[model samples]
Target chain A: MSRNLLLISTSTTHGTGYLEHAEEEIKSLLEGKKSILFIPYARPGGISHSDYTAKAREAFERWGISVSGVHEYDDPVKAVNEAEAVFIGGGNTFVLLRNLYANKLVEPLRHRVLKGMPYMGTSAGTNVAGRTIGTTNDMPIVHVKTFDALQLVPFNINPHFQDPDPNSTHMGETRDTRIAEFHHHNRQPVIGLREGSMLRVKGDGVKLLGPHTARVFLQGQKPMEFKTTEEIHFLMDAY
Target chain B: MSRNLLLISTSTTHGTGYLEHAEEEIKSLLEGKKSILFIPYARPGGISHSDYTAKAREAFERWGISVSGVHEYDDPVKAVNEAEAVFIGGGNTFVLLRNLYANKLVEPLRHRVLKGMPYMGTSAGTNVAGRTIGTTNDMPIVHVKTFDALQLVPFNINPHFQDPDPNSTHMGETRDTRIAEFHHHNRQPVIGLREGSMLRVKGDGVKLLGPHTARVFLQGQKPMEFKTTEEIHFLMDAY
Candidate 1:
């Protein structure tokens, strides 16, 4: 079975409502699904799980889908097993992966998704679906047992990727600089998803979705800019 | 003896030479010292440890101080114990902490500094000198054994902190937003040191150095803006 996933760069774009920009893709991916198992584990900005889940519910409910948070169930593993679909919202990657490990849901969710469960992720949510959380832009607010994440995708995902601002004088490392640093110890390719872009994967097929172009960084070569119109099926073998 | 440290925000400000902005502080901290042991483990931009050390040597040579990298020593702990002064330059914090632990130098370096040996750090270097590396702004490019650090200071440090750009259309979390998330899980106060800033800790006094104001985030309180002239001695009790 092929994994069905819509990994978004962000839940909301500047001056836009939550998931507003990706509504069309979200609707397309969840077609015919009656409900979604929302994973609010990332808890963007440290909001409570329930509060975070409510945000996801509010968005999905408008699209005519019933949404329940994974936290609502005693057995999170079983929830994934019975869910029609899973949607993990964006937040702190460390917190998201830590809770996944804490709940022992990484393997089970990976298994369920491999069997073709529709999976949706935004930002930090998308970061965890990749080979490892090594390229995340989030602060290490919490420590996880390992940086190794779900092998749902062979390459790592870098959400909210912004190119270096030429006129700016800031001294922090640029997104590209950090990704290059990541290549020093890691050999996996990284998909740098700009604010409005995303990756849609179905079985052996993959497409870069949205209006912006994605930056693909390989270990030994210069990073390539992939347009939404380009074919990235070869990325399936990125491992 | 009290810890003596000059933890700087960044080694190079936008148009300045390496350590140019913090030359006075560097000189004051290492006064009369004949030689310095440098920890170039952070290896900025993925440069080799030796090449990184050469960068430090070139900068300090102008100031008339002899420099050597810890990597050159047979044992890092012994090097830290014997050095007249220690300076850790900036790069990737995880790599720095991982190597510090791998070489078993964290505790020895901590002990040496607590004896009043001058300790200096820039960016990732300043980050690890804090209670933990939990508030770092760098990408989690590697798996560290732990987020715990030297505890040279009672609070965590967020170096190279930039305020939200009012004109930025970027949707990524702002520095303040990330620090707030850090406060949720960590109680220690965080000093959001902007570029060109440095923190000086002497026997019983601490001074915030540089022209820019620093943002201090404490759990449950509105983050306060602190100035270079303000007294932050209270931060020692932050733990």
Candidate 2:
């Protein structure tokens, strides 16, 4: 049975208000699924079990899809194993990585997804699906025991991309400068995702979502911008 | 006639308590100089001109050295040109870099220092002397206009290198893990300096200071640790 996965960059209850479209896309993904489970285990946002469960319930109810909050289950693997599809909400990338490692879910989650289980991740959750967890700029507000992450995607993803903050006083390299520095050493391409956007990967290819632009940075070259509708064929070729 | 240049990482009056030691170091470096002109152009910590001038005056008074604060000079090159040895107080590296670039002081400072003006740097000031400002862990709280550095030292220096925070919940990556990842891509060696420790480069050799340890990391190898008194002969070899 081939299952699908949806990863969202954020799970703000109102959806990405910019396009007023996250809910619609999510509903379309879950429309015909027989079993749906919400895994909020990557609760870096200090989200309690109940809070995450409630958010999942809210989103599911809006779409009229029966959803179960699986975090309450003693064995998350068992819960995930039975689910036809999974949706992960976002908060802090480090928090999510910590939770995933703490729950020993990296391998199991990777296994389920590889076996054709539908998986979805937003924000921090989407960060976990990348090759390395170094792209995140969120503060290490909490310490998780391990630094390993799921290597579903082969490149680093910088979400919530924006220009340099105008009011900051401590002088340091900007995000663009830091990314350029990263490129000086890393050959891997970094994908910068703006707000109200996503990269949908089916099998091995990724497609952009929403109206925002994405930037691809490679070593010794200028960062190239791409539209949301362009096919991310380069990622497959590079990796 | 040689002037004194006292480069400190933090402003002494900022309540960081390193002012006494920094004062002593400066006095030792400028033993025979009777009058010292203080230049506070790298003002990144939101330090007011009067406040910085007063701090320099206090340090000089304690050392029994005559002092003149030159904060009103407006032009860094002009201010630096007349100084015997300039003391650069550190707050943030990026802020310092920005001011240095805006004032066009890199060439003047470099030329003066190379001409046997005893140069001293603490913390962020020391970072500016490095080949590149890539190893700093300071928050990108502000953006500098450029990434250019003074390049007094050939390698990147990680200052205030304490062990990983025990209470931090961020399980993303340890400094070691991040450095390892950095090594995977970057071939340059990173010198980790613990608090109270300093790296002194004279001629072609580098020496460590204070009671802490320095760790040198290179690609494909275990990090090599060194004591404060040890000579970092490898740095000489690199140059």
True contacts kept of each: 0.89, 0.00
Q: Which stretches of candidate 2 lie over 4 Å from their true place?
A: A1-3, A13-20, A144-146, A165-170, B1-239
lDDT of 2 by residue, A135-228 (tens): 6655433444444467666777776665565653323445676666555335667787766677777777778887778888776788888897
Best by TM-score: 1
- Tens-place lDDT per residue, model 1, B1-46, is 4889999999999899999999998999999998999999988899
Q: Which ten residues in a row have the lowest lDDT in candidate 1 chain B?
A: B230-239
Model 2 lDDT, residue A184, Cα? 39
Number of the predicted model whose DockQ against the real structure is largest: 1
User: How far in Å is the alpha carbon of B205 misplaced in model 2?
Assistant: 34
Q: Please give the lDDT score at residue A175 for candidate 2.
A: 63
lDDT of 1: 0.92
Two-chain complex of model 2, DockQ on C-alpha atoms against the true structure: 0.04
Worst 10 residues of 2 chain B by lDDT: B1-10
Candidate 1: CAPRI quality band? high
